[model samples]
Target: MARYAILVRGINVGTAKRVAMADLRAVLEESGFSAVRTHLNSGNAVGTGNDGLDPAEAGARVEEALAARTGVSARTLVLTAGQLRTIAAGLPYAAEMAAVEKAGSRMMAHVLFADPDPALLAEHDLTAIDPGNVQLGERVVYQWCPNGLLESPDVSGWITKNLHVEVTTRNWNTIAKLADLL
Candidate 1:
């Protein structure tokens, strides 16, 4: 069995895309995922499944199920437990304890598809990110958008609008919990 963290985008935002976490958990359980757990109301789920099922397919199934039940289409990003662990271990902010402390805030790491082109990273102006910070990694981008998540520029929105890759974000707390889950 493989453990996976599934992120469902555009749910529970404003009046649109509303999905109950309980219903999501039920859908995953019905879909044959074991040890299923949800984090917050933002559509983050940790579950384990048999080796026969593909992770991407599982994600799509879950998205479809959620949309069919809730009348909203969700973009799902699926990552193995190991992949999430690697992302947590490679966090640049972990080494800069002082800067992290002084920032008096938390950070979020956005997992993006691996791309070699520099243009993909430069698509968004760094200055517009505000007190929010951004760092491009080999397969992810670290964002420190501290003025609360909704207030900050939607990094996922910008990336999707400008880049041709899939991206999903998790806050520091979510990352830490995911590490614990792994």
Candidate 2:
């Protein structure tokens, strides 16, 4: 069996895409995943699935099941337990970023396309901006918004405009918790 971490984008932010965590767990279990568990209110789940299924395949199954059960389309990012751990461990500027967050800055991690083109990172030249710092990793991008998500400079906007890559951002805190769940 392989453990996978699933991230659903824009599912529980407001009342619009509400999906109860319990329901999500039930959905995954019913879809043949075992030891399903969810963390926090956001659609993050970690579970063991049948052997030979990769993260992409597992994610597709979960997304289909979720749409069928909840009647809402959701974009999901699924990573293996090893991938999740690597992402958490590879976070840069831990103390400095934490201090910024403690001082009211927001730390967000953008999960890039499942197979983000390496050239895209170079094409856009994601860099540190005023009142915020952006760093691109293997399959994740870290941005510390000193102001806030709404107030900070449009990191996602520029990425979408220039690179045209689909991404979903989650707070570093949520990511850390997800890592722990795995």
Candidate 3:
């Protein structure tokens, strides 16, 4: 079996694509996944499944199972344990971005499906961010926009709303915690 982290987008937000974690787990288990566990309620799951399936195939299977159970289509992203570890290690903002020790402040890394097109990164007006704090990696982009994630224009709704790519974000703290889970 191979371990994977599966993230489903657009779930439990303003009542669209609502999938209870229990139901999601049931579907995954029914589809032959083992050691299933969910994080929070935003459709993040860490589990073990058949080794032969790739992330894309695992995502498709999860989506199909979820739609069958909840009657809502979901966009999913799956990362293997090794891939997740690589992403955690490759975070660009780890050294440059200051840590926020406050209760709700978040330090996050957004995992992109592919290395962003260099042309797109070049075109984005990144002048608003501290040049030293931003690190662009092969499949991850790290930004230490501290004052709460919503406050940073560089890491806010704009990137997710405008960029035509699939991204799944996890706070630095969450990344560390999940590493232990693996």
What are the per-residue Cα lDDT tens digits for candidate 3 across 2-100? 888777877887878788999989978876678988887877778888887778877888789888898979878788888788877776654444444
Query: Which prediction has more favorable lDDT, 2 or 3?
Result: 2
Candidate 1 wrong stretches, greater than 4 Å: 95-105, 113-132, 146-154
Point out the higher-scoring one by TM-score: 1 or 3: 3
**Per-residue lDDT for 27-122 in model 1, tens only?**
788766889899888888899988767767877888778777777788887777877787777776665444444332357777774453568557
> What's the ranking of the predictions by lDDT, best on top?
2, 1, 3
Q: For each candidate, C-alpha RMSD in Å? A: 3.5, 2.3, 2.9
Q: In terms of TM-score, how similar is model 3 to the real structure?
A: 0.81
Task: Put down candidate 2 lDDT per residue, 1-182, tens digits, no spaces.
Answer: 88878888889887888998988998788777899888888888888876677677767777899999988788877888887888788787576665663632377777875655668766656784533378777677777776677877777667766667777777877788888887
Best by lDDT: 2
Residue 152, model 3, lDDT:
61
> Higher-lDDT candidate among 1 and 2?
2
Q: What TM-score, computed on C-alpha atoms, does each candidate reach?
A: 0.78, 0.88, 0.81
- Output the better candidate (2/3) by TM-score: 2
